[model samples]
Target: MEIGEDYRDAVLPQSRWEKRKFVRCDFTEADLRGLVTQGCTFEECDFTRTDLGESKHDSTAFRSCVFDRTVLAEITWTGCSLLGSSFVDCRLRKIKVRETDFTLVSLGRADLRQCELSGLRFREANLVEANLSGARLRDTDLRAARLLGTDLSETDLRGAKLDADALVQAKFTGARVDLDTAIAFAAAHGLIISS
Candidate 1:
């Protein structure tokens, strides 16, 4: 267990941690590339300007953490929980997520273009002004998520669950959707559909 520890600018590459607990830890500008963690919990941790590239986490929990300008390229997360975590200006390219819960997480203005986001839950997540162009959201749950000014252009939303009211607020230019989603979106905007 690590509590209130400061690891700023520390280099801990390729470290493996399991079932460890961290509370209020500051990893600002730290180099944690290729780190692997399983069943680890990090609460209120600050990852400002940290490099966590190529890191892999399984069943980890990051509650109320802050990731500002962090490098998360090629990171993989499986069955992870990032509840109330906020990511701002983070580098998230080639990130793979599976069955992750992002409930109440703030991803505002994050660029996630062409990312594969299947079977993930984003309930009540703040995705305002985020760019999700060409992203595959198949079977993803985004209920009650804030999508105001979110760019979903050319994004595949098949089998994705989202509220029609939320969908109306997002930009859906060239977005692919199922018939049920299309009908619900049209009805939410008071559009009359004729059979």
Candidate 2:
């Protein structure tokens, strides 16, 4: 069912939003925990500071959405599309984002610790100052992605594809990688890894 086409601060929680559509809606500070949605669409929506933890979403599409400081911990989002979305200072720990498209998304200062983001595409996305410590990014593509001041300490980067320029510009202090990846990164910086 479609509701709140252009409303602000609407409280919609613990409801099933199957095949629903929301346009220019604002759910700021709303408690949406344990919400279930499937094939839902949100355009230019604002979910700033919303409590969306433990929510389950499948095939949901969001275009130009803002989730600034939203609590999305333990959320399950599968087959979702978040194009041009911004998630500033949001809590994203333990969130499952499988088969999702986050093209051009901005995750400025988001908490993504311990999240498993394997094989995900982060082309041109911004993750500045975000906490990715202990996160598993195996085979994740970070081409042209901005990771300046990103906290990748102790994070696993096995098979993660990074752009030469972006990787050099990012901060990976104390981050962990396999020997092959380490050698590759060293070679990119004109350093020879001699045995």
Name the top lDDT candidate.
Answer: 1
lDDT of 2 by residue, 14-49 (tens): 878889888888788888889999999998889989
lDDT of each: 0.95, 0.82
Model 1 alpha-carbon drift over 4 Å, by segment: none
Q: Per-residue lDDT of 1-195 in model 1, one digit per residue for the tens?
A: 999999989999999999999999999999999999999999999999999999999999999999999999999999999999999999999999998999999999999999999789999999999999999998889999999999999999998998986778999999999989999988988999998
- Which regions of candidate 2 are displaced past 4 Å? 1-4, 173-180, 192-195
